[model samples]
Target chain A: MEHRIESGADALYMDERDHVATALRDMKAGETVQYRNAEGLRAVTVVDDIPFGHKVAVVAVEEGADVRKYGEVIGRAVVSITVGQHVHVHNIEGIRGRGDLGSKEAAAQ
Target chain B: MMNGTFMGYQRANGDIGIRNHLLIIPTVICSNQVCNRIMQMVPGGVAIPHQHGCSQIGADKDRTFDVLAGTGKNPNVGAVIIISLGCEVVDPAALAEEIRKTGKPVEFFDIQSVGGSVKAISHGAELAKRMMADLEKQEKVPVPWNKLKVGVKCGGSDATSGLSSNPALGAAADSLIAEGGSIVIGETTEIIGAEHLLAERCVTPEVSNQLYHIVNRFEDEVQRMGADMRGGNPSPGNIAGGLSTIEEKSLGCISKCGKAPIQGVIEYAENIPDHGLYFMDSPGNDIECVSGMAAGGAHIVCFTTGRGTPTGAAVIPVIKITGNKMTFRNMEDNMDVDVSDMLDGTGSLEQAGDRIWQEIKEVAEGKWTKAEVLGHQEFSINRIGPSL
Candidate 1:
């Protein structure tokens, strides 16, 4: 069972068909986990869920862009998220962008 | 006329229908049981039981009245047998008179006038059977694809729906427009953070302003209730299913209407006129949304979802499609098409669109959708005011 993230998609998608979900739950840094779609061997997906789909939260405030899943922004890290740390509402917040924010046109109406 | 060419009754008001049946229309709640009893004796009859038609004032009452009239005027119905419990604000005879203008036959009886439910049912059954017998005699004609008006709807959406089924359905909606057909997309509340995207697509500034205004009206109502949309619509299951924000949900929601230049915006459940794309202001509740479209004159609805809901309408046929592979696997009984290939890369968006378009054509030609086959005829009119 292989699932690969599609190209042009914004999410750092993790396809979990071949590997165990627990591996993503327990694995630490320096472990090279692979992610594959039908495109056949694109790139390795780091086993992480919360903050970034990359390595777990490591630093105090991450500087990288927030990773998107399901085509919507989930959370943000002021600095880089290192491997194996709980990423919750405290670390990340809703996305702020043009057309990405709550509608203002109707708010006044 | 060519034999076996997708037959539906040719209504007197110059419309064609894929289904030919006499409907039992109840004017008030007091007459629902009597309507049901009449349906027991007639096989090809439908009963629409609603809690409206009394104590409703102003726009609230008018909205209910219009929907009932639209249901009666729907081309699918060959005739209507109205069952009214006397002493209601809604005049059954007046409703029957409005339906008669469509040239479809109508008959009405009041339970109070007939002395009770039993007598009314007996009288209604006779009228219904006679109407059905006449309806059974109406023949189908080869309707031009241009006469086809479809509603594009999405509900129980998750993140994947925008990426898969919704976009794929958008493709199909574009195809329908290309063939000179019309499509209407509704769910005003669901449009939340993305009404501007849709407003930009409107063909005119007035239409765009209408879109903006509908969203505003909905927001005002929410504030009046001392609640925000974030508290409802995008349920907890949607969050767990991979949705992050209502804005995220809305971006996905709008995809069901392909990239056609929107011709106009319409009120909730208002009749769709002419060809091309339209926006209907409505809440995201699936049943009420579907009802709005049906009452607005859509012959069928293309409903896409990732959360796998089993809902259909009493009058319109709902074609269900799914994008989540797990949902497809688990809810095969409810789902009609699978676009999981968008995720797995087995199929292209065009392929999925073509498949759905073919299904729409076949459904228009008398093929029963899974919803209809499974008897999922759900109906709920959006009540704008408190149920006083």
Candidate 2:
């Protein structure tokens, strides 16, 4: 997917499949930020303050659903996330390299 | 724009060196002081004082010896002086002999043989002075890009790392490979979740299997400890910078190597091939990883970071590039290049990549990186087992 540069974009999404866009600057709650994705320039009014270098959901995600970034699964959503809400450890859980989960799977097997 | 050729020192073993270093190696931790003393006495002398070399057995001992010997044999080093503290698991003679095979001058002795630390320091200082004199006389000639081997690495990463600096460095890596040069990517732990992506890019089935093997081995080791890699991996700092999972971090981390097809996988500190892109099995710890690359014969390392790191190697130059503008503005003394403008829609990826490519050429031709100028000679070796 192409990342076309749109002047004055407040955030950037790497691929068309990415569910979240990364904040280019600290954004306030209830603020509308513009970002460029494969679909071109789009706007999202954030429900939560997003810090610079942090991720903000560009599309809504249901709990336990895979979150894609760079056109790959980054993690699974731990809670239902709304569009424009902050997306990070608070709302998502990493599924790989979880030795805590590996032992549990071993016991179940 | 500068030409494609870089002015570099021609080594006796047909290797090209960007820096002609007079390297002083301490064969054992016990000899660190003497080695450091000699470094102080002899101008232009660089010493690597590491913790291993004593009470290590089997592969562990061999790894320490290999890393030390490899660092000495690095083309960047013009000559070497090895100091040992009489009795250590690492044999000083064998270490010197290994480096001598490179056709470079090597001198070695033990503190016991030279009376003590004071006498050894004096003797080592004398030897280093003479070697430094000879190294100063070597001339640098025009060398093509194919003669260089560059290592791409990322540490203290944040969200912007994958988006900007890392991929930009990847472009630079690809540019070097296009010139028939070599690029080595490591930090096997960081690539755990993203190994499958890299595997698909391997040139052969065997190379892909090796990639998976290393990833599986690391995961099994982590599982053996019954501990999660979360807190340790998407490190507290990484989390603070918005990297939530190892998968996300790994995906971002691998982008620094560009899109080159993987040619082969080599053990840590093993000699990197003369050309093509290779992967070295190594740890994610900043100093240990960079040290391994240096030992593997990397002439220079291009390190990308979101949170700034002041890591450098004993004999090789580390070019620090950052994607976080604040981190760059705050740590300007430690940072060499800033590509954060790409995140702000102010700079294109090609411009960022070209900026790094220009920096690589400049550093290759004798320009000092901020790490080198600030004297950040950080080095560490990855161990397989406990010290005996």
Candidate 3:
């Protein structure tokens, strides 16, 4: 994926396939932030107040669908997420190293 | 620009050391007070007082013994004085013998045979003063970059760690590797979902399989206890800093090692080879991981943190780099490098990488890291088995 190092962007999205953009600063609800991705620069209006260094969804995600970051799957969406919503543990759950799920779904498998 | 060389003390066994430290080691918990007292009485003396030395069996005892011997053998230490209680499971004589193989001055005695802590402290102090005087006579010679071995680690991570500091440190790691220096990356428990990426980068199938084996071993142990790594992996601070999953954290964590192909996978506290990149199997606990790296012979450590930590090692310098502007500003005394500008668009990734690389070069050439200046000589050993 193309990575351009330009100035003055509000959020940063690492890959073109990523559904979320990390807020570079504390962002309030309804504020549109610009970011650069493989497809070129784009803007998204945040629906939730996202804190600095937090993730904000750039596209709508269906529950149980994989969420991508750094061009790889980071976790699975636990709940349907709308564009510009804060994407974090509240909405996403990790699928690896879940020994609490019992031996059937142990991390080794 | 400075030349790619640093002034280093040349040891008797031909190993180059950046620091000429007089180390005092306690063979058992019973001798800790005496060692500490001796360290206090003598100038330029460092003491390591640990909890393990007795009641450990088999592999556990072996690990403790290896770490103690390895620490004493580190090129950073010029002379070693080992104090034992004489009743501990760990053998002080053997430990001193292993260190003496380096051809450095090694002295060992028992508090029991020396007639208790008071006399032991006085005797140890006298030996340490004499050793320190001799170490002062040693002169540093010009050493090439290839003589350096650095350990890359990340802790108290935040989302910014992945976005900035980690990748920046990765660039520094790559630069060091390009210069024929060595880099070792550990924290097997943190590399859960990202093991495949690292495994694919292994130089051979054997190394790749070993990477998978270590990951599976950690997972099996977690499964045996019916405990989920999630309950502790991202940790409360990590979650508050916006890291949601171990997969995300691991991806960022691995980036600190750069893109060097894995040469081999070694056990925790095992001696790191003289050159290239190696992966050591170690836990994610900050102190234990750093200590393991020190025992493995890392001359220095480049640590990236977003939430910030003041952790340092007893035998190595830990250079702290952070990706959060606020964190760096708030903890400037502890942080050595700030690469947070990558997030705000004020700096490019390459520029941030260069910044870290420059810091590493300077630190290698006798510059003190913030952790060292603050006297944070934290040490801990990773245990594999229960104490008997």
- Interface RMSD values for the candidates, listed in order? 8.0, 2.2, 2.2
TM-score of every model? 0.84, 0.97, 0.97
For chain B alone, what TM-score does every candidate structure achieve against the true structure?
A: 0.96, 0.98, 0.98
- At residue B237, what lDDT does model 3 achieve? 92
**lDDT by residue (tens digit), candidate 3, B209-322:** 999999989878877777657659889999999898988899878999999999999999999997789999999999999999999989999999999999888988999999
* CA shift of B232, model 2, Å: 1.0
Q: List DockQ, one per candidate, in order.
A: 0.13, 0.58, 0.60
Error of 2 at B352 (Å): 0.9
Best by lDDT: 2
lDDT of every predicted structure (CA atoms): 0.71, 0.90, 0.89
Q: Of 2 and 3, which scores higher on lDDT?
A: 2
Task: Report residue B355 deviation for candidate 1 (angstroms).
Answer: 0.8
Stretches of candidate 1 off by over 4 Å are A1-109, B1-7
Q: Name the Cα RMSD for model 2.
A: 1.9
Give every candidate's TM-score on chain A: 0.36, 0.87, 0.88
Error of 2 at B208 (Å): 0.4
List model 2 lDDT by residue over B176-232, tens digit each: 998889999999999977899999999999999999999888887887877768889
Tens-digit lDDT track of model 1 for B86-186: 98878888888987888988888899889898888888988888888877776777666766789998877765677679888998899888887789999
